[model samples]
Target: MPHLTSPAPTTAERIRSACARAGGALLAVEGDDPVAVPVHHLLSDGSFAVAVPLDRVSTASHGMAGSQALLELTDYAPLPVREPVRSLVWVRGVLHSIPPSELTETLDAIATENPNPALLQVETPRSTPTNDDETRYTLLRLDIASVVVTDSTGAEPVPAADLLAARPDPFCDVEATLLWHLTTAHNDIVARLVSRLPASLRRGQVHPLGLDRYGLRFRVEGNDGDHDVRLPFHKPVDDMIALRQAIRVLMGCPFLNGLRARR
Candidate 1:
């Protein structure tokens, strides 16, 4: 992929998009004996709401509000690649337990945004009720303090304000579906697109890696190793029609062959 020398402002938006698709995150509590747990999460308005089984709730925190914690979210390529991890976002925040009174409202909001079968378990009754807290569930909220995004561009801290204000790319959610279609259903198109790469890279097996409003990313498998490259659109696209048009233009470019030789 094109090396981004400095972290872009879009980093925050990309992090948010990743969180939406991740389904869950790795929560790490800071202390002498740190605890880490995988918990289902929802990110909204710069805060992360996580659903933890009653058993792991105390491990996540000391049952204290305003505790310090870190939430790590990763973005991976939809397809197989040498380096599947595209990026990582670490969120530093203060953790707080949600009151039982608000659990219903909190879970409803999470379901409305990203529905998952696991959330349904919360509504089901447990047959055996032991005083063991593990029989129940708890919702924990992490109030944002800072967000650090690490990718090919390198790691940098994004201001809480900037992270809250940013919005994910218009095509963030559907890019994976579209890329999957292009790779599985459209080999001829992919070949034509790969013909645009530099002559040295054309010998490699190319596959779609990712897509964003700015461009398309591909993974090239060669004898030495796998490499990533970005093919930028002539202009950024916002809607499906425009994205299609831009792709068509890229594939139809007669000068791509010539450009390959020059590269």
Candidate 2:
């Protein structure tokens, strides 16, 4: 795999897509004794909304309204692998608790995006104090000030304005399904795709790791080590049909002569 030296503007958009697709994020509160908690989150625009349990809320230094905090979200290969991490995104921001008057609206937005059952418990009533934990779920909005993205390439700071304006990749939500199908249902194509890799990388088992409008990413596992390679498309695609056409073109010219070297 080649290392990315020059920063790509799309890095911020990729980070946002990862946050949206991630099951949850490790939220680290900045303070004397920092606390890290895993909470389901929804990313929209430049902000993040996470559903935190009331019991664990206080532990988060900035769990209340008008506080500052940091959040870390990671994207990993859908399949098990020696090196699963694909990318990491760190967000620094101010935290603000959702007011009682806005709880319903917040929950509705979360459900609309994530459709997680835990979000529905926010409105359910319970009889016992222990079961009353339902009301304990609170939504905290993180007003993002800055975003940093790190991956095989390196760490790159993303301007808040660019991060806010960039949208996730067109296939962000269904990349997993597409990759799984490519790896399982189309072994012949996978083998042809692997042929495009450098001789040193051809020894390992090749599997689809990710896909986006720009290109496809593959994971190679061998005795030496695990490596990831990104194969760019002839042009950026916008829909499934175009994406399929790009894949066909990629497979047709496995060597991808004259194209930008993988990085």
Candidate 3:
């Protein structure tokens, strides 16, 4: 089935849209580079270039015939503008070349929005097998797909018509979904903190007092009497501090970093 790739939007606009849509966007590109890296390379003819690295050459050729590949560009870069690095606006679309005249606006937008724009130089693909020079390549004009915009400000509760137009969806459903996931994640912390309690202290008298500013509070009844205990979970979710310490531990889990704050 043919996938629909949306038009390009401003980076600021895309981040705002992405934030509004959610924290970040997931792009499906058949390539060898990281999703955030640019696949565009400048040519002498003033056109964008798409490079098919050696590893992905076969895949690119199989899918897109005649030295061209479809790409879904996303702005997943973490801009270190705030304490917690702010997420950038990401756009996704089928990157295909149009007549130079038609791409005037799109070209201008890419130049302004890209944070660290790099070029991809596609080498020509050779059919003949050679022992000396095994590698071959092909370069094509760069193009983009949908632009998912978002930011810290997000969409106001009462948004203006123009402001609403800038968003990918009708409203800020992405942020709403993220908040929902975060809220439900509180239960996970409650379970973990309860498990951490000593079995002797957890026996007969441990009664949960519910969560508060201090964290999970419980009254433990021992042979003597009842004693109040609080488990302050500063980083129940993705603790940046602990994350650094246990980066290796979380390397396998892609969603671990985002869910840490909820824990």
- Give the candidate number with the greatest lDDT: 2
Model 3 lDDT tens row, 185-239: 5555434445566566565455443221113345555676555554443332233
Candidate 2: minimum summed lDDT over ten consecutive residues — where? 1-10
Structural similarity to truth (TM-score) of each candidate? 0.77, 0.78, 0.28
lDDT assessment of candidate 2: 0.71
Best candidate per TM-score, number?
A: 2
Once fitted onto the true fold, the runs of candidate 1 whose alpha carbons sit more than 4 angstroms away are 1-9, 31-45, 58-61, 122-136, 200-205, 221-226, 253-263
Model 3 TM: 0.28
* Tens digit of per-residue lDDT, candidate 2, span 117-175: 66654533331344642445556788888889888778888877776677778888888
Instruction: Rank by TM-score, highest first.
Output: 2, 1, 3
Q: Put the candidates in lDDT order, highest first.
A: 2, 1, 3
What C-alpha lDDT does candidate 1 achieve relative to the native structure?
A: 0.69
- Model 3 is weakest, by summed lDDT over 10 consecutive residues, at 76-85
Model 3 residue runs over 4 Å out of place are: 1-27, 30-38, 41-52, 65-84, 97-121, 124-145, 155-263
Write down the worst ten-residue block by lDDT for model 1: 1-10
Look at candidate 2 and tell me the lDDT of residue 148.
90
- Error (Å) of candidate 3 at residue 162 is 13
Q: Taking the tens digit of each residue's C-alpha lDDT, what string does model 1 give over 13-98?
A: 77767776664567776652433334445455667776556556555445636778888888888887778888888888888877
Q: Flag the better candidate by lDDT, 1 or 2.
A: 2
